[model samples]
Target: MSDLRDAAMSSKAWPFEEARRVLKRYQKQPPEKGYVLFQTGYGPSGLPHIGTFGEVARTTMVKRAFEVISDIPTKLISFSDDLDGMRKVPGNVPNAASLEEHLQKPLTAVPDPFGTHESFGHHNNAKLRSFLDTFGFEYEFISAKEFYESGQFDEILKRAVEKYDEIMAVMLKSLREERASTYSIFLPIHPETGRVLYVPMKNVDAENYTITFDDEEGKEWTIPVTGGNVKFQWKPDFGARWAALGVDFEMFGKDHSTNAPIYDQICRILGWRAPEHFTFELFLDENGQKISKTSGNGVSIDEWLTYASSESLAYFMYLKPKTAKRMHFDVIPKAVDEYHQQLRAYETQDTKARLNNPVFHIHGHNVPTSDMVVPFSMLLNMASVSSAEDKETLWGFIRRYASEASPENNPTLDDAVGFAVRYYHDFVKPAKTYRAPTDQEREALSDLATALSSEEAALAAIAAKNAKMGRDDPLPEADFSDPEFLQAIVFAIGKLKEFEPLRDWFTAIYEVLLGASQGPRFGGFIALYGVEETIALIESALAGEFTK
Candidate 1:
């Protein structure tokens, strides 16, 4: 047991810990469904956001960990509650005024305002599928409309009919009197109006699997619990779906944590043990407000992929699931760089160390090597200093730094180069503010420029001397692109000019040359941008060119 399996079993990583808990569940006997089922629920009231995709990504991580430690087969279901009634028309969607008439109808029943799909629910569900597919999530898609309408939920629906009073007794304890007075487990889909009627049921005929309820107009109607006649109210649906599918694990946002016991009790009443559940802290926008699709407060999943790889977004989701994350554009470059950092670290790790790595959970057994030569943050800084308008302009510098690299051979680097350009225009370009250097700063920068110019002159003399002796190889070029060498030169100048703490020197360099208050290491920037170019930039800043 001292091998990879032993390491996997003892790993303290969150996904492995969650998986071990599940593995303990079926230690005596495998599940009757022949596999452990992991389910993630989605509400199709609006287009899916980056946070929506995160739920599936996190669940997949746990599912892979479970596979590592247990022999039991596993399955994942990306469930959509499309039968949920549209309580209010969202202010963001097109033709929202036209959707008012359809309020209280199941999302699947309302006509799509977008003129795309047959119903609004389908439109949102399609978007959700596309978002998940973009990340290559392996799972089966189940729609609530299809599950209930096709009679797959009939058995559980009938079970709820038998246990209706018991379930309501548990639910009423959590609700205020105003809500408890009219709440019923069954919400009947109106046979005529096509709206989901929320009226209290007068009687539950468990023997016949039917419900009798009064509609809004005080009209009496008796409908079967089976088929498309009725759907469970959301809270009951939560547990009933768990019982119906024999789910072993599920996860949701922390907002649902309070209702977890109710879901468990109802599932028990329906003759199935509750699934193990995880409640992750809600994702937030830059302002710390909960991220929402309609509020449009954070970057959409597609929008994130616009300037970064899908893997970087997945890495962000993989980290600190129990803590709230601010999902904004500014987090992209850091996520990209950190993901590659992990990938590089993975190359040297042993079995035990690999088990705890996020990339292992993220990629499962199919982890791909990171081909990014330049860190993404460095690339963004490069974009700022170089003002690269196109990927081609950045590629020229990249090819110089990595002599053997090309777009075709280094696709990840190529993609990052393009991302840097787009990110610069959208974010950095808008926020940049330039200022002329202070008296001490200007003097120090001039000295640094002189130092580089002096080095260039000495190199020219050496090249001429070597030509006279026919040693035209030019003394092996001194590795001028090495960041440490360039950094040493900058450090020497900062000390000679007596800049307190030395960081002040770099700060002035950023503000004057890049028009930003902070930047990447000045030496590394020079290494990538070329020594001569940086000297010219320093000369340009001393003349107050950027301040103008």
Candidate 2:
């Protein structure tokens, strides 16, 4: 292992440390194929949403981390359960009546309600692939229907049929008494209607690998278990897929956690071990309700990409996957800003710190040195104040503030500028509120304006004089070259007595400038937006222009 990977493996930080643990476990019992297989599953019952993106992005992060510490080749399978039956028409999809007509039919057999692709399942699968491709995720896409029809799952299906009694015993142990008598591991497909029938199998001929079942019309038939003749229930299929694909690792949401033990037992019955599993909390909306694709209540992948970068979304997923997080439009700006911050930190931090940073994993250990001229939050403030409709206007301010920075040299910042503009228009504009500063706060603000006029004025000196500030650690000598110096100034300003709680003062400043009650850190905002422009904004607020 390289020194950097060695250091990364040593750190107890999230994914890298988790990856090391997984690698060590694999090392104890190496795969026969000499490679690790990571799987992220998608159910094709609905269009791909942000939750789908999160699973793939997070799994990719782990896979990338695994690649760094070990030479074991890794492959990620983006598997789609397209053969699943459509139990009900999704509330968000078009043509609900048409979808309802196909209830209980295989997703692949149902027509696309939107009239877009060959089948409903095909439409969803194509969408899933397109978005994953858009993010440049490296994974092999596999459809359950294709695997079943192509005989890839034949061996597993036969094994399941032969072990039907054992599988049923495992499945029945956890079910309620009322439902246990009727439950069967196999769900046969009716040849006449092409619908996946839920009726119990009347008889199973293990030697012939055949199951007999009656269709909806009471017509009885027997079919071979192999060659797409039957499909296993979800729990059994989960176990069978693990055995069939040799899945080394798979992560899923907590809702399916209860099924893990059952799947493990089923896999054991098949003479194979279950893959290393991770269960994560589900994504919730701002209202604390679960985010669902069918409900269409949460942000979509396309919506996020419209206002943020893929890296931002990836970073959002990287944080505390075990804890449920509210994912909505409101979370986008912070995620975008944090992604930029991580990139900036990656450029300056040491290898150990870089390993802990999200950008290091988000880029798969190839952490990019950022040329960010300004933070995203600051760009949003600029967008709000200037009402910049295009990149040219934003670049005009960027050029004036950071003479060395330009769209040509700082592509990431340039892209962020566009995102900030869109985010402001969509999310920030509607909720903006400007509260007039109190007399005491206005006087303090005027002092800040006077200090800005001096070419050599320091933020620390201004803060100390205005608020009687004291710190256990003595302030460093004023050096404009240090970014932390600007942060300190903003920190001190926030501590001023004029705005008693600091949040009020922060709100006052943001309200005066952007008509918003909260915004980017004031020091960074001033540095990127220019001292003169900010002074003018304060003056404009005092003059009552912003209130109008």
Stretches of candidate 1 exceeding 4 Å from the true structure: 456-478
By TM-score, the best candidate is 1
lDDT of 2 by residue, 62-152 (tens): 8888888887899999999888888888898888887778998899999998899999999999999999998889999999888998999
Residue-level error in angstroms, candidate 2, position 354: 2.9
TM-score of each: 0.94, 0.91
Best model per lDDT: 1
Q: Following a full C-alpha superposition, what root-mean-square deviation does model 2 have from the true structure? A: 3.1
lDDT tens digits, residues 1-548, model 1?
34767888889999999999888889899998899999999998887888789899999999999988887899999999999999988766899999999999999988898999999999999999987887788899999999999999999998898888899999999999999999998899999999998889899998998999888998999989899789998999999999999988999999999999999999899988898988899998899899887667788887898999999999999999999888899899889989999999899998888888889988987888888888887788788877889998888888888888899998898999998999999999999898988899988888777767766643444455455446656243445667876776676677667788989988888888888887777778888888899888888888878877
lDDT (C-alpha, whole model) for all candidates: 0.87, 0.82
Model 2 residue 357 CA deviation in Å: 2.4
